[model samples]
Target chain A: MTATTTVLISDRPIDPDRLAADFRKQTAGSGAIAAFVGQTRAEAGAVKALALEHYAGFTEDAIAAIVDEAVSRWPLHAVSIAHRIGRMAPGDPIVFVAAAADHRRAAFEAVDFLMDYLKSEAPFWKQEVSDAGSRWIEPTDRDRQDIRRWRSAPHSGEQ
Target chain B: MTTRILFFGQLRETAGRAETAVDLPPSVATRSALIDWLAKDDPALHAALNQDSVRLCIDKKVVLAEATFSAPNEIAFLPPFSGG
Candidate 1:
């Protein structure tokens, strides 16, 4: 079956459970499904809000490219990604990724691979608003390291 | 011809605006030349754009600084991405 991919960038709130359910239905015959949801942290009251900004057309295209890479690397049946733009309060969902494949390992690894790339390389700017002030966040060294691991790993097609 | 230049993330903050349009001169043809030209009046913007971490996009597609094009509709200066 041809892989079904859904990518969305929204200014409003995202419903992770709803997206997961919808994705589940889309990949019904797949043997496994892996999903991840990321949320803004309150940071123990230091953070008041988190703001995400993206280039209208370019950002979506960049993310879709990453999704395509993931599909090419794994034997995925479907993938869905949704990210929130604009201001979000603490506890709000920031992003969601789900992958379905014929086996558990493929589904699990695809979701992990997608998130690592999204955190470090996706075309979105993130800022943490706090009582002190707002500051733009950059990818940490660990984030870069996480993504680098996949660079050396052999892809399914390459093997 | 007029080219639209964009700044994102901290670059946008440094530029004090998200985008601007500039009419290019013949000398300001390459991406590096364009940055120098744009920064002629704004030192801080020049420094921000000069950072190695900053990437250039021409007409919505990321390209190397050495890449050259004529009368491209858009050019964006992007800082390192921090999403998810």
Candidate 2:
């Protein structure tokens, strides 16, 4: 198949290798592949658990939009993204992203681009439960700037 | 025009539901205008909506502050994303 495919889900646990392999097969002719995995750290600071909330229908659509944008902006063969929802412990896997392309540059750049958009643009909210209290998490200015950098950064498909 | 407004994350929990219908004032024409009108109704929504961490999408596409939406549109307001 010459079409790009995507997998977006809000499951409890995500299979990292499987996700990577799926993208690999989809982009079989690709010479390079890139995958980024975000896992829960043991130290959530004062938080015990994090409750991830998302708009059921809108979440998938928004993520799909991001994938489509990446596919258009890069010569990507395939991509996969999966995010976890519900109450998660500190050590749980938070997110997974994999991209494949015919060249290392496109695969690497596309994966980074997708991650930047996903971080600031996706519709997932994190609520931290601590011994003292619980509250909603907000993105720091750092996160915003990280995403902003991508707008001006060079990419494989662009001059 | 009838539009659907969706809330996500803690905002949805705080608002007690995921989606709502926002009847814009006759003069309201853009997304920012709709936000301004809604904020006037609830101070919390006003504050929450103003935070930079919130993202706005019109008809399933992310939109800037000055974007406009017509009838039967779907607009979503969500908190900062933590997706990988």
In terms of lDDT, model 1 sits at 0.92
lDDT of 1 by residue, A27-120 (tens): 8999999999999999888999999999999999999899999988898999999999999999999999999998989898999999999999
Error of 2 at A154 (Å): 3.3
Regions more than 4 Å wrong, model 1: A156-159
Give the per-residue lDDT digits (tens) of candidate 1, residues B1-84.
788899999999999999999887877777779889999899998889998899999899999878887888888999999999
* TM-score of every prediction relative to native: 0.96, 0.77
- Winning candidate number (DockQ): 1
Worst 10 residues of 2 chain A by lDDT: A1-10
Cα deviation of A127 in candidate 2 (Å)?
1.9
| Candidate 2 wrongly placed segments (more than 4 Å) | A1-3, A156-159, B1-5, B20-42, B50-75
| Chain B fold agreement for model 2, TM-score | 0.79
Is model 1 an incorrect, acceptable, medium or high docking prediction?
Answer: high
Q: How much does each candidate deviate at the interface, measured as C-alpha RMSD after superposition? A: 0.5, 2.0
Local error of candidate 2 at B54, Å?
4.4
**Model 1: what is its DockQ?**
0.89
